[model samples]
Target: MSDDLTTLHDDGVLEIPISLESAGNSLDGDSIRNGTDALHEVMRGHRKARAVLLVGKGKNFCAGGNVAHFGGADDRRQFLRGLAHDLNTFTDALYATQLPTAAAVSGWAAGAGMSLALHADFAVGEPGTRLRPAYPGIGLSPDGGMSWLLPRIVGLGRARTILMRDEVLNAQTALDLALLSELVDADQVYTRAREIAADLANGPTGAYAAIRRLLMTTYSNTLSEHVIAEADAIADLSITGEGVEGVNAFLAKRAPDFPSARN
Candidate 1:
């Protein structure tokens, strides 16, 4: 992976840094491209990353898109279309990944940055961390699944209020609204996030993936259909090595050692 966008940690954590000190860590075209490419590489088995950690390099997490680029683009329409396309693709990949994901957020998470952080299964933020939709403020519509995710996360009315009013939510508010999984000290954000990711990585990956799939389709499925899906999922998983091991471990009164860990 390119150092500019991401770095793979030895503990199987893929770290994508959203901050660029020179540009105040704002999202840029290159960062979007590189970060997405890195995610694809990991998903395709080109790299070994059991979990992903989205973070910012400096004090601020991400300041959203580079507005300067928007003004400078000779073909503003084409530029914006391409940028949004790449960002949407990246966010899609993030949501589809089998690996559990986490984020260590600080300072500001605005626009696409907020979307990216929200995509993670678990996001840890400090007390000072702030989240904003930031689209209406700049006369733009939501992208990167913000429209879909926000409503699901905070309900339709609250999501509408947030987007329409450009409400900036602090870490506590975000946590209260279920946007953040945990709130920690500024210095402990990354450490706590990584610890959570590592714990997830060591657990039953297949089961985790199954749960993600089930939840992703929950709203779309009827209760009868959902129960059938759940039954099928459990039946399928029951025969897997991890599932067998887990069952056996339970019966034997011992800890389960998942097959993924052995590999």
Candidate 2:
């Protein structure tokens, strides 16, 4: 990996390797500014990336914010607040891309680390992987969208219990709760995530984006309102080259070659 640890593969998957054993990727500090910049490039459609793959390199996927830094700051309150703004900035850029995303989460995902993994549409982990809503343990509430994401993935009641109780969830439990989408062996986590992300990149990128939009907004819409949104999405999609190619491929009885229709 290079200084920024970001690479765009030939397959149209943007591979961002989180290294130094925990990405220590604070939403607050400068540690993740490079990633934020990369995501901004994607949002501008300059990267030509169809999907994103996040790989964790180390014994743990991420240990969250560097606790040492947390304590080192002289003005602790201002420092934390600044970090919050940075975290929000990074996450907002990632969300704006509307691309399919996956993560190779191989070991302990704690504190902001768990929140980061939750951003992925699919998180591939090992059987030994673990998740902990470690914010409270550090005398803080959740950041990095943890508060919003947990409830959506596991339900409000269950999410509440987990957060309030500061639970350390095992890999199997995390998978069962839909927190981790897939589980493989420890060594295969990154490979599996890349495979899945590449497959997504080759798919109908526009449709995947629409699905992400629908799912993210579903809770805010009632049945009647949601159906209208769904109709609008498909109607808009039908007029695109991707839609036409999909229909033609189906009629021709062959798999869709979406890349050929890429604009």
Candidate 3:
């Protein structure tokens, strides 16, 4: 738990830990920039890693933008643009990552905090964890792909209610609504997430990335266009060496060599 916003570690398993501790008392201004920079560096260094596991220390996952740093900017337009840019950078990095990713939430995930958790491929929270979309509550709108991700996860009506009402959804309720991928005891959150990450690390990495590509394309694609895109992907994959190895492995009743992924 360093004063820096993020801590990176490799734990023998292919997945690495991207710990979000704190930058002092509050996440105020410049914290998001610092955090994102650190995360970018971590990602660059671990290009071969299979997954990212996000964990937080202290009472909450994050309390959103530092209010102390909010109103001081002289140019309102510049400030808003900077905020949007940073959020998009952070989320794009997360979503475009080749490996699987998971968030282990042990405490409160509020505002952009919830957005960060939602960005993960899978979110695992502790039993008593609380998640609040703190956007509308503070007269601010959603960012960090919240508008794009939330409705897809929980449907339009539920997403609207959560955003408009600013309700605090607990971990259990989050799981019930399909907003969370799993729930575990508070102390076991990171452990369970790590286990799952390890499993994904050892699984079909290329196939998982292909699935991610399809889902991302589906976001703005028409049905007919998506069908054409899918056909292209299927044809491309069929010619790939890994795809051939996978088919051979299945027929031979053996594990896939994934020769293309060999380091």
| Candidate that would win on TM-score | 2
Best-to-worst order by lDDT is 1, 2, 3
Which wins on lDDT, candidate 1 or candidate 3?
1
lDDT of 3 by residue, 1-263 (tens): 23354444343233322223464222333555655565565568743455666655555566665554567778866886787787777666665566677777768777777887887788888778888888786688887787778898888998999999998998889889876799887778878877877766666666777778888778699999999988887777776777777788899998886735443
Count of backbone clashes, every candidate in sequence: 1, 3, 1
Clash total of candidate 3: 1
Give candidate 3's error at residue 31 in angstroms: 6.8
- Evaluated at residue 30, the lDDT of candidate 2 is 40
Clashes of 1: 1
**Candidate 1 global CA lDDT score:** 0.84
Give the best candidate by lDDT: 1
Better of 2 and 3 by TM-score: 2
Residue 1, model 2: lDDT of 23
Give TM per candidate.
0.93, 0.94, 0.82
- The predictions' CA RMSDs to the true structure, in order, are 1.8, 2.0, 3.6
lDDT of 2 by residue, 104-175 (tens): 898888887798899999999898998998888888899889999999999999999999999999999999
Model 3 / residue 132 / CA error / Å = 0.9
Error of 3 at 170 (Å): 1.0
Which residue pairs in candidate 3 collide?
28-66
Q: Is candidate 1 or candidate 2 better by TM-score?
A: 2
